[model samples]
Target chain A: MTSPLVTVTDLKVHFPIKKGILAKTVGHVYAVDGISFDIMPGETIGIVGESGCGKTTAGMAMVQLTPVTSGAVLWKGRDMAEMTRSELRALRREMQLIFQDPYSSLNPRMTVRQILSDPMDVHGLFTGHQRKERIDFLLDTVGLSPGQADLYPHEFSGGQRQRIGIARALALDPCLIIGDEPVSALDVSIQAQIINLLKRLKRDFNLSLIIISHDLAVVEYICDRIIVMYLGKIVEAADYASLYKNPRHPYTRTLMSAIPVPDPARRTRRIILKGDVPSPISPPDGCRFHTRCPDRMEICHKQEPAMRRFGNRHTAACHLYTDEQAEPVENKPKAKEKIS
Target chain B: MDQKTQASILSIQNLKTHFFSRKGVARAVDGVSFDLIPGQVLGIVGESGCGKSVTAQSVMGLVPNPPGKVVGGKIFFHHRDLLTLTVQELRKIRGAGIAMIFQEPMTSLNPVYTIGNQISEMFRLHKKLGKKQALAAAIDMLERVQIPSPHKRVHEYPHQLSGGMRQRAMIAMAMSCNPEILIADEPTTALDVTVQAQILDLMHRLKEEFSTAIQLITHDLGVIAEMADQVVVMYAGQVVEQARTVELFQHTLHPYTRGLLASIPVLGHRTLGKDEDLVEIKGMIPSLYDLPAGCRFSNRCPKVMDMCKNHLPDLIDMGGGHQVRCWLHTREMIS
Candidate 1:
């Protein structure tokens, strides 16, 4: 296998919580804490988590939109963390992000043509006729007619607006695209269209994509590999087949069960996570999922489990799969029973 | 089946809800019709701008005044034409007979007012109860919706509650008067999967308890399959297909409905491999402002014919309460 186009190591984004008249930094919200992953060239890596699990923050940190507290964001052998101002500006052309809400992401006042051409103008990529030609090409590439370039965002439907967002992201022919819940906001029928478009564009452009979404089904459709996050940690990371077929982590299993099965007759026992997600400001001490984990043990309550590798590509941060507690499924309960 | 079992609690016939926009007349709900039977859940599934929502708003008489106009159709509620009712008469039936829970609970709820105050206001206005009596009723309603510590929660404002709690509060408010019918327009769309499951389960339990007919309008097929007793697939402001939930899933006749079912990527299903490709229905939903003369879906339909372009297809009954509006299906039946 070739080297990954982008490699993120120990990426942490913390927001300071200030208070009082002096506005002292009292604490910090550990949004994305020490998450590490890689995006292979021309491959899609999906990041799935519940709301406020810091998936969006992780994506933002990758693109330098959010300040990273500690980590090395190595882009093609070069660390983005060490990139200078001008270098970072140049890197922006190769790393583009498509926001979730097309309505808010795109400038409502600007026409589609103006919105698509803004990136080129900022980078000084093309001039005059060349720019006009590129804008029309992008519009056509995204399944929109050349005539639609003049229309504003509001005039288009949600799907069309999203296409414009995609076109804008591809304006500079970026090597990597970070789609932050891109299709979650669109209608299901329209979501299929956008997903297909993204898949086609990924192949056509040979782009490495990091898709951040809460929808497991959407992720299952598009991503080659997935990293499931809980609270502020990656609980499980595996290829799409293994993650769905045999989810190791309790949270991943719960998330898989939560996806609504379209066929009513095919009844799968749903593993309902008991409580609401804990506050990110002050996450639980041990396992972040222990609060709602069905098979939580006393050891799980006191000790934070480290991420353990299983086989070649699968990795999970759970006590159940750890080598120290290598026991059968039936005997696993005995360990918890003894711990209690 | 008994005659009364087939009776529709709410029946909308030939409904045409139009919005007079500055650009042109937007046919948001152009000639939509459906029946909601008692103790049944009718799922209205459609993409955005397909007029499923407009049809719901038309039923509730909640269409915005300036531009929206119900030009045609009779909305019969308990055999009484809702469109013909006076403002005072409709006001009396609004919450007591038919209640609606919108998508965004925060927007629907008053920010300044406490949850208790808002809930009690429904009781006071409709039931003509005293302040103290209404407050008790409000607390009971809150407790019934499974809100933890109803007394404490009732005092909190809408902003104080979480998204799931807010939706529960909204549901509590809607069911306070023991309404005959509940209209949930994408109630769980904005919520997370777990919250959405809980909401769907709550609705299921509430239906069994109250025996209230529900009209669920959403774009999610998964939600529809889970909750709906009957399903109505809409496209371009018309009911393209209608069938029992299981029947619709098993034997989808209409091309649009078939395409929709195929498009959804189900869990445990085969993934789209390198060789495998997704079957996307091409072309956008035509602008409601200027829809084509014939079948609206003819433009995007893979099995479209010359006849489909020339004339609109009538929703023909194909037995077992399955109705579909497509020339291909009609032709197959005729042949």
Candidate 2:
């Protein structure tokens, strides 16, 4: 990786819980606890996890939208945490974030013209006439008509609003774009359109994209590599082909199996996980997934496993895969259980 | 599971549920028709504005009146025409004969009331059970739905419970009356994958244990494939394709169905390859307020013919009870 665009080193973000009356500091919600990854230039990396897994927190923390408790996020080999106000402001122009729900993320009062130009205005990039021209270019780039720029977000449909959101993200000519569940809120038919638009934009701009979504299929389709997070930690990180072919982590396996295959006849026996994700406030001791993992060993409840590397660029955090003294359970295909 | 052999538990005949808003008349469920078999899961699959949820609401008699109305057609439940029934008569059948479970567990459950009170209300109203008996029955129902520590959980409010547990409690309340049909409208859509799997498994087990006909409505094809015995593919509030689950997947007749299946990025080795764009349906779903004259999907249909643009096609019954509504298929039938 020739000087990665961004590198996150052992990042941890803990949100403090405040109680009644005195507003006393209670326990902390370990949102993005000790996670690390790198984004190479123009590469699309996907971060996937269910609700409360801290994928969103990690994405926001990377962009400096959320305050980080500890560790460093290096933007082009420079520590972003240490950057001064002026430096951080300059960096913001090259990095951007797109939210899941376009309806809520976008301001209803602002017209599409204002929404796209305001970001550039904040950065002091283009002014007045130049900004207007730039906004038109952006609208056209996102497949929306230049005339529609005068209308408010309410005037457009869910799909068009998302396009507007995308146009706003692209306004500053950002090198990196973080889409947190970007297409999840959109309808099935419209989702594909937005996804295709994202893919095309990424290619056209040579942009480094970080797509965070719970939908495995969506991630697999677009992302060159995927990072699977479980309880504020990355359980597995692998390239698309390797991850889909041989997923090592029990949680990842369960998640992959849980996805409803469109074709009924090709349905695989689902490894139905037993329970919900343990509360993030006080996550399970040792391995966070031990309580739900079917193939759990004694060590999983006592010690957290390190993320070990496998076939080229593939890594998984599971005792089963780690080179440890404990007898490893032979990974075998489970008996086919009928869904009906 | 032959359609003719299995007795139709609930039959919908050309049901037209239209919403009369100030803007225009949105034909949410325009001439949609399907039959649910006893103890069988019938999946209604469509994207958001395609009227899958409205169809479920129409069946439950829960569609809001002033703006909404079942303008035309018949809904036969146990050979009784539900459309003709009065509000009071429909109320009797709601919890006891047919139950409904919504997508958002939080909204469906009352935040102020305890789980026990909510569940017991069903038994009290439908089964005529007293407070003591109703509470006991509610706890039993909670246990049946596999909500851990039913005794403690029953006393807890909805806010105290997690997303999965809240849905489980909702299911418990739905099953408290032991209704003949359960209309689960995107029941697990709001939960996590693991939680979704658990809820789906619970629904499957309950169907087997109680022999309750389930009308599962969702946009997820994967959910439809796993749970449905039969599927009705709707487009613009109309049944585009209806067939047995296996047959539907194997021989997908409708172009719209094919497009939907292709649009989704499948896991493992599948159709889409590297560097290939997903086959998207060209345009947006036709506006229900003013649908195209011919086929609802004709505007975006790849194999659209001249007749498709001019005249609407009827649902033509192919062999083995597989029906497809398209000019191409109907033309083939005519030939």
TM-score to true structure, per model = 0.94, 0.95
Per-candidate count of clashing residue pairs (backbone under 3 Å): 0, 0
lDDT of 2: 0.90
Highest lDDT against the true fold, candidate? 2
Q: Across residues B223-316, which tens digit of lDDT does each residue of candidate 2 receive?
A: 9999999999999989999999999999999999999988887776422355356777787887788899898898999999998988999998
Top candidate when judged by TM-score against the true structure: 2
Per-residue CA lDDT of candidate 1, range B174-226, in tens?
Answer: 99999999999999998888778778888988999999999999988888888
Model 1 C-alpha lDDT per residue in residues A1-340, reported as the tens digit of each score = 6998889899999999999999999999999988998888899999999888999999999889889999888999899989999999999999999989988998999999899889998999878889889988999999999998899999998899999999999999999999999998886667888998999998899998899999888888888899999887999999898888778898888888877787766545677655468889999888888888877887787889888877678889887765754232445765453222
Residue pairs that clash (backbone atoms under 3 angstroms), model 2: none
The C-alpha lDDT values of all candidates are 0.88, 0.90
The two-chain DockQ for each candidate, comma-separated, is 0.53, 0.64
